[model samples]
Structure formats: structure tokens, C-alpha cells
Target: MAAAGWAPPRLPGFILTERLGTGTYATVYKAYRKTDTREVVAIKCVSKRSLNRASVENLLTEIEILKTIRHPHIVELKDFQWDSDHIYLIMEFCAGGDLSRFIRMRRILPEKVARIFLQQLACALKFLHDHNISHLDLKPQNILLSTPENPQLKLADFGFAQYMSPWDEKHVLRGSPLYMAPEMVCCQQYDARVDLWSVGVILYEALFGRPPFASRSFAELEEKIRSDRAIETDLVVEAVKKDQEGDASAALSLYCKALEYFVPALYYESDARRKEAIRAKVGQYISRAEELKALVTSSSKSLLQQGNPARELLREMAKDKPRLCAALDVASAAIAKEEEGKDDNDTLKLYQHSLGELLLLLAAEPAGRRRELLHAEIQALMARAEYLKDQMKMREAQSMGKEALAEPVRSTCTLQ
Candidate 1:
């Protein structure tokens, strides 16, 4: 009986064929023009009664964004109309449905396929980035596929999007909790970087068939993103085992990762005794990590000097470009200094200097083999610099924490 009574909304100049989809406040239907061309389009009919003040503003913003932009990967809004009871938006009819259905059909995507999809998504994001627009709600359900054959991703749902500069920060909640950044969930100010974090989660889900947290509760996801205590514990245990086994290089990397998580743990600790205990552990980690930095430096230098075909080839490729050649040489010197077991401060400076030069080079580098090599080198240097930076912070925190622990622990009991 329910199926027998279904009827599409009445609209002029178009013949409604079937119901395509539905949401909380709107229903979409496949329709065709009544003219000779019979142009097909998807009409999103939003009930006027369902929209409040905020939703009306969001709807206007979405229309303005879609009207002004013309990217291949972003959904298009051709026109809009309003009657007594409802508002209608005429959108491009995508034959292949949204990305959520695509992923559900495949269970998991191959790495190559996933990478291609990610590249397309990045192109769309870069366009938005150039315009200073943040699609605060980026999820699989909001990404549509343009066609059934050779389907291309079209980022949709700008209901929560906003024009935000990189340095502009806000604390208002704007996204699904499952894909939101820790800073957003914790009521802390967050900027455009939240989009990058969502992209990472989407990529992970594409490759693995589910998110990293799977079916975990929001609290568990929050802990994983914020404190990361369990992850830190696992990493440090492995780091210690590696250190005992004399693998200084691997241990150093693991220790740095563990130290990054300890920052939050220290910030949230309330008990005096527990804070002291955590600080003692951190101090021990700082000592070993510092020693390993020197050992790893010399070990890496020798090994790198023995064989670094990639670096040598890159240097050779840049022989014609003097500025690029200079940047490559600076990178080489950074490696050499690390290999020579030089001071960590000096080595870190060299790495950062090279990175600044190389990043500039990369932005102007054309699409080709050399450009690909340059990008890879930049990524490697960025990772190294981040690790070194984390270690440096750990050392500073150890000093401050030790000083704080100098005083005797105060009991919670109040004196009468």
C-alpha cells in the first residue's frame, strides 16, 4: 500500500521520473525537461517548513559557493526555485551514486586505485584551498561519482562549508564525530588542517574497508586521537626492546613517536604522584633518545656514504639547474653532518634549510620524473625534521618537568 501511493513532487517544465534519494530535510528525484531536448537533471526539493534560521543560512552559502565555482570534481548547482511549500535546487544527475556506495560494493580498494582516487580528491581540495574554502564536512557519503563508466569523484554537500583562511581558527563543532580532528572534538581552536586530517581518515578507510577506529565508541576514538596512551606505550616498549638489541636508529624513531603522545598525557595529569612517575619515565626516555641520536647519526652517515643511489641520481639530474643543484648539495651536507655524528642542533638546522629551498623548488617544478623525485626527497626531509623537532621538544619538556618535580608531593587532604 505504501509503494502504491508514492508520487514525485510537482514542478513546471519537468517530468519527474523516480525518487533518487532522500535526506532529513530534502528529497531528490530524477527528472527530465518537458521540451524537445528533455534534459535530465536531479532536483533536490527541500521542504521550507523543515529549515530553521541556521539551515537557511547554510543553504544560501552552499548555493553561493556552487554558483561561483566551476571545478570538474565539485558538484554543480544549475538553478534553484521556491514555491509555497518547498525550495527546489536543480543539480547535475550523477549516474554512479556517492562514494560510500562505491566502497560498500568493493569492500576494499587496491592501493593503486585508492591512490588514484586520493589524487583526484587532492585536486578538488587544492581548488578549495586556493579559494580559502573549507569543506568542514568531508566524508564518503558527501562525495559523489559523476558517471558509471570512468566515474570521477565530485565533492558534494557544502552545507557545512565555510571560507576560512589557514590562520583563522574556530571552536564551533562542524563535522561528523567519526571523522573530526581531536582539536575540534576537544573544543579547542582548529584551522584548515582539520580538512587534511579528514582526508587521511578517508584514505585509510578506502584502503582498509573501514576506518582506523572501526566500531569503537567516540570516547575510544577521542583517546586515540588525543592522549594516544595505548599507542605510546606500545611504541616505547618496542623502542626499549630495539635499544637493548642495539638497533639505535629504529629505536630513535620509535622513541620520538612515543614522546609526541606524552605531551597530552602530561597536560591532563592531575595527581602529583602520577605526574612525578610520568616525568621520571620521560626523563629516562630523553636520555636514551639523545644518546641514540648521536649513535644513529654516525651509523647512518657511514651507511649513506656507502650507498645512496637516489641522492646521487637526483644531484646528477639537477646539474643544469644551478639553484636546484645548490639545494641538492645542501641536502647532501645535511646527510653528511648526521653521518659524521655532528651536533643535533647543527644537523637540524641544515635539514630545515635544505627543506625550505627544496619546497620552493617543488612548487615550481613541472610534472615529470625529476619533479616526482624532488617531491619524494621533500617528504623524506620533512619526516626527518619532524622527528628531530619532536626529540628537541622532549628534551626541553624533560628539563621543565624535572624542575617541577623538585618540590615535595602535596597531599590532597586539607589542613583543618
Candidate 2:
């Protein structure tokens, strides 16, 4: 989806070149000084027409913070100027682009390499911490690498940052749900430690190549963060065994199970370094799971088989419930389509429609074993749908590589 304010503004002193990226309220561009030195820079342009009271305050704060902070690891806000139409933040340019693209290009970073980058991030955070500032939106997208070779991490994007002390607390959703701390996400009072939680998530993604709680929606992400770990250790152990035994399907399932706990663990852990270690593991496991999911096209279907038994149990339990039976029938057709190796997208849609009907019924059911069985069946259906989604992504990625069928994330997507 296009963001709110995505227009590029004409600046008198600089020549705006290609677009960089956009956020909810600002669009950044790559520009060069028109003077003798001709230094390259990034200009963040915010359209005045799009700013409300809250966004204006955020823009002001971002300017105030970046202009004042001069740490080597933090992005330098070289200067700022405003016109009748828009607000422009001219800042130092990082050649290698944001960390998200950096990691995507390499697939995953080595632990040693990730450690160096993490240390740079920690240094920048420590500076912020000592100065009583909290960067609430510390995701991979906000971290930039100076150059692809000998890359140096530079922290940027301070629109959600606040000058909260270690003890000061506030209750508001301040950042993206995928990387948000549980306290902030759950709407509890959160302090500077919230940044630490984000730090862990970033570190985890650096290791695993994706966030631990990445989901199709905010609801699913919240559930993963709130749910218990169910002996996450046991899950990782089994995953390790399965991976060694060449069961990619089982291994992928177990790794996802392990990740469901890792997010909550990140919340409660106090020691910073220990949290980083746990987060590192989450990333590696997630990366492996994603890799396994891609290859699931050729791997065994143990998880699919397990989800099948639940489908049978649901059909038996729905003997007296006509609507429930009908939903089960739809689910059966979805399974049939999958077994025939037809269009996975069509099968996924059928499962989604059936699950929608079953979930409403499941919600009203009294506390009993039948309700439990229905819930299990829903989860099974969801697992199948998720597998199909992953299969589609794998195919999409391969096709893009072979035929250049899609736009790269870093290239032009903004409306300006």
C-alpha cells in the first residue's frame, strides 16, 4: 500500500535523483549538493498537506533528535529547511541502503558478521540510552549500511523516537507490530527497555533472515507474542533431531513451535547480551525453517498427515451440526484439490472460507472436548493454508530470479 505523504519536493541547493523509500508520513530521495563539493545525501520530504497534529509533532521531534545527535553510528541530519508546501530533512547518505535489503541480498548473514553489525547497533543504542532517548522503531528497515563492502551500520528514522528515561513509562502503540515490544503492543506501560526488545528482534532477524513473529496479520503476531513457549527447549531439540534425520517438514514445524516462545522470552529477559543470544538463535532457526518450507514442495508431508486426522475427527464431531458439516465438506474439497496437485491458491481460498465458518461456530461452543476438537481442526486447516502460502512464495521467488518478474523492494515504489 502507498504511504500517506509520498511527494518529492524541489530543493534549491540539491539535485534530487532517484527515490530512496517512503514511510507513513515521509518520502526519502537520493540527492546531491549542487555546490562545488557535490556530496550525496538523502532528503526526507514530508508534504504539509498530509500532516495532522500528531504527525507534525513526530516530524519536529525527529528533526530535533537527529540534528542534535552526532554519534558516528547514528545518521547525521546535516540540515533541514521548509517551504510552503513541504518539510525537507537533508541527511547523510548511506550507499549500501537499508539493512533489510542488505540481508535480503545475502540471504542470511554469518554470525561473526552479524555480531559486528549488532555491536554497532548496540553502541548507537547505548548512546541513545545514556542520553535518555528511546528509538521505538528499531527495525531492519531503519538501520543502514554505509557501503556493501566494509559496511558500517547507521541507525536512522527517528519519527517514533522519544526522550524517555530508563524509568519513565508510557502506554501507547509506538511502532510496527511485527517488531514492537509486548508491553507496547499489549498497550501496557512501556519504558526505554522497549527499544531493547526491538534490538533483540533485529538481532534475531539478522541471524534467522526473518522476524520470529512474522505473520499475515497483526492478530496472528499478537497471539504468537502472548502465547507460552511450551518448553521451547524441547521444540528446538526435536527440530535439531528432525533436521539431522532429513525430515524437513517436521523440522520446519518444530522450529516454528520454538519461535512462538522465543518472542515472550525476549520480553521478560533482563540481561541485554543474553537476550541477543536467544534472539540470534531465533533468527537461525527461522531462516532454516523458511528454507525448509521452500523445499517442502519436494519434502515429506508429515505435518500435512497430522493435520488430516484432525479433519476426520472434526467431520465425526459435526454429525449433528449441518453448518459445521458443510464447512468440513469445503475443507475436504480443499484437501482433495491439494492431493491432486492442482492450484494451491484455490485450495488455500477454500480452506480460508471453511475456517471462517468453523471459527464463528467454534467461538459460540461451550467449554468441552468438542470445542477443543474444533479448535484443533481450525489450527490444522490454518497450517495447510500457511504451507500453501509458503509454496507460492517459493515459486514466486524462483520465477522472479529466472524471469525478473517483479520489482525489487528497494527500487521505486513510492507515488511521488
Candidate 3:
């Protein structure tokens, strides 16, 4: 249950069909507007009493911000109503789930796919910034994709968003610790750049399959973020250093060095052009890193680190039987190249292989590390699976010549 009121007066022509989601402050339900030809919508119910005067004022401010902006990438707010106990916001429902779930099935999205999604998100952010509105909570869970083929990415859940001049600054910590900018973690005043920092985090996750800073606990995550620590594992450092040593990869090495320098520059300096260039280059590096990391992370080192007996056998087999090892290597390289060239279908295949490999590795690992690794791997695989399923369903509907595709299932609190 959320802090919001559990019940409210039944508004005319609106029939609540199912629960969509529950959050700290509100519960959203899938409902239909019966009077206006039975239009489907998502109604967010918020308790008027649960919110303090300041928070209530903020809600009103959000309403005002929504009313001012009308973009395809921004979710449409249909109506706002309240009785004595609760306030309800009627909005267009996105058939596809949030971005977090989408990312779970696909460990890492390809560069082109991520760029398309980010471009739409960037447009919406730019619109909000132009209006002096800052979406304090900018995470994958708050971003919703409308459908599979026409996956219109829309930003949602603006309850924590605020409006302030670009020049204005306030020292208050807000948003999820994993996505919070370094300055925000330190409780320093930040500008629109804070939102950009969050965008960078999302971009990182899209390419790397995990948040830039991840930890088992919020306290640990906060400390890591506040200290401006990079989540680059030793394997990643070694890979980069190896690349730097190769003359063939010297250009790539320089590009990575420039990107590393740029992250800190945004923290210390306020040069706009330099930041933009850095962001563009960082995006490229993240994409390339995805390909390289996948190869390295799936290699013998990762398996041996988990103490997999099968990996030891596999290694011995490779050394003892050279032809067989070469065949396996060629097969793996071919699959990787195929996935790199593939669009939607290739993405699904890549996820399937990764998921299979992870499960196999997990089964061979000790129990202590197995749980943690399995949880992370499952999250990444599930997100990609959902994305593929959604895409397939949309394609099937189009083949059948349907006027409008059916909506995906909405979240429910319980079986009842």
C-alpha cells in the first residue's frame, strides 16, 4: 500500500479496471473514460492528506508544468480532479512498461538503438529545461515506452520534479543515489546539468547493462558516488591498458582518455561546448565498450573467478585439442559479429546467449557469489526478453492488419 489514500469517490464515467502500479506516495490504476467513448487511461490516485503543504504545492507545480508542455516524448496529462480525500491525475496509458524493465531483458542495447531512445529523451529534457522545469527523478523506471515498433519514449512520474531558473541553485539532495550526480550526492546546489548527469547515467546503463555506480546498499552506493569513484572493474582497466599498448588501437585509446578527462571536467568547470563534445564521445566509447566488455566478461577469466570446474576443463580441452579450440573460438567470434550487425532480432539472440551463459556459469559457482550474480544476470536478461516479446507482438498485430495494437498487461498489487 502507498501513503496515498486507499479510496476515493467514484468519478462519473471512469471505471477503474486494474491496478497499474503502487509507489511511495500514490497508486496508479488502469481505467477507462466511459463517457467519452470508453477511452483508456491511467489514473494516479494520491492522498491529499499524506502530502505536507510544501509537497501539495509541488504537486500543483507539476500540474502546471505538464499543462505548459505538449511533446510526443512527454506523457499526456488528460485531467486532474480531487475529492476531499484524494487527488487523481488522468493520463494516457503507455502499453509497454517502464525503461527499467525494458533494460532488464536486454543486458546492453546497441549503439544505434540507444541513440534513438536517447535522442527522444533528450528532446523532452530540452523542452522541460526551456520551460525551467527540472525532473529531479530521472531513472529508467520513470521512462515508459509506448509500444514496440513505434516505441515512443515518454517521460513519466514527475512528482519529484521542480521548476527553477537555470541560474538558480539549491543545496538539497534528491533522486536515487545510483543516478545522482556527484555534486548532488554532496548536497551542493546544481542546475539543469544535474538532469544531464542523470541522462549520462542512463546512457551508461544502456551500454554497460548496469548502473554506473551499483552497490548492495544505498549507503554504500552513496559513498561511492560522493567520492566520484568509477565503477571500472580491474578487468575493464586491464582491457583499456591493453588497447592503449596496441598501435592499431591508439586512436581508440586516445578517445577513451579524452572521455575520462571530460567526466571530471563537467564536475569542475562549466564550459558548455566542451561538455557537449565530451558527452558525444562518451556515448561512442560506451557503445564500443559494450562489445569489448561482452567478450572479456564472458571469457575464461570470469568463469575461473567463480571457480567453475567446467571452465578449467574447457581450458584444458582447448590446449590439448588445438583444432577443437580454434573451431569454438571461430564460432564465438562469428556469433558476436552477427549480433553486432543484427538489429532487433540480433539483439534478442544476443540476450538469449548471454542469459544461457550466465545461467551455466551461475550453476558452477559457489553459493555465496551465485545469488548475487544470478540476481544481476536475471535483471539484465528479463529486460531484454520483455523488449523482444513486445516487439514480436506488435509485428504480429501489424501482420493481421489491426487498426490499433492491443495494450500490454498493467502491473497489479496482488492476485486479487
Tell me the RMSD of model 2 versus the true structure: 20.0
The number of the candidate with the highest lDDT is: 2
How accurate locally is residue 298 in candidate 1, as Cα lDDT from 0 to 100?
A: 68
- Model 3: per-residue Cα lDDT over 1-416, one tens digit each: 22345443476668876677887777788788878588888888887778887778778887888777789999999888888878898888998878888888887777788999999999999998888888988999999989856588999988778887799786777788788887787777787679998998998788667886888887777677655333453334554676666532333333344444344433433444444444444455555644443454355234323432343344453465454344334434434544454565655665565566555555655555434545454454455455344444434423322211122222233214
List runs of model 2 lying over 4 Å from the truth: 1-7, 230-416
Model 1, 240-349: lDDT tens digits are: 89999999878887776666546444544556655566667766777788788788766654644554346667777899999999887887787777657678798899
Q: Which ten residues in a row have the lowest lDDT in candidate 3?
A: 401-410
Q: Is candidate 1 or candidate 2 better by TM-score?
A: 2
Identify the superior model by lDDT, candidate 1 or candidate 2.
2
Residues 251-272 of candidate 2: C-alpha lDDT, one tens digit per residue: 7777766665565554445555
TM-score of 1: 0.55
Better of 1 and 3 by lDDT: 1
| TM-score of decoy 2 | 0.58
Which stretches of candidate 3 lie above 4 Å from their native place? Answer: 1-9, 226-229, 233-416
